[model samples]
Target: MAKITYIEHNGTEHVVEVANGMTVMEGARDNSIPGIEADCGGACACSTCHVYVHPDWVDRLPGKDSMEEDMLDFAYEPDTQRSRLTCQLKVTDALDGLVVQLPEKQI
Candidate 1:
């Protein structure tokens, strides 16, 4: 399992353990972390689960696919380098201690 930190725009932080193979969005939804609405339920069809990967972990995570990139366009104030759709990120041992900050709002 990986321990991921989800930080809200208002500075709240939720750190939870996510099982391997589960999407990051699932981790937030299951743990009841606010800010990640996940309207599509980890289907990669919506931007409600968007977050900005902490700069320190930016290069550490996997690259985004076309679907994730497209979905991010609908996120609120997406940052080209850091914005990502949580549903597209799968948990793994390598992602342990990963940190992501929620946008001010999800569009």
Candidate 2:
């Protein structure tokens, strides 16, 4: 499992243990972390699960695909370098201590 940290716009922090093979969005949803709405469940059909990966982890995580990149265009104030769709991030041991910051609002 990986220990992931989800930070809300107001600075609220939620640290949870996510099993390998689960998506980052699933980790937040299962833990009832409020910042990630995950409107489409684990499917990358919406941008409600958008987050800004901590700069320190931007490269450590997997690269975004065309689909995730397209969905991010609909996210709230997306950052070219840090923005990502949580549903697209599969958890692994390498993601231990991953930190993601939620946007003020999701579009």
Poorest stretch of ten by lDDT in candidate 2: 35-44
Error of 1 at 16 (Å): 0.7
In order, candidate lDDTs are 0.93, 0.95
| Model 1 lDDT, full chain set | 0.93
- Tens-place lDDT digits, model 1, residues 1-107: 99999999999989999999999999999999999999998888999999999999989888998988888888899999999899989999999999999989898
Tens digit per residue, CA lDDT, model 2, 1-107: 99999999999999999999999999999999998999899689999999999999998988999999999999999999999999999999999999999999999
TM-score (C-alpha) between model 1 and the true structure? 0.97
Query: Which regions of candidate 2 deviate over 4 angstroms?
Result: none
Give candidate 1 regions above 4 Å deviation.
Answer: none
In model 1, the number of clashes is 0
lDDT of 1 at 88: 89
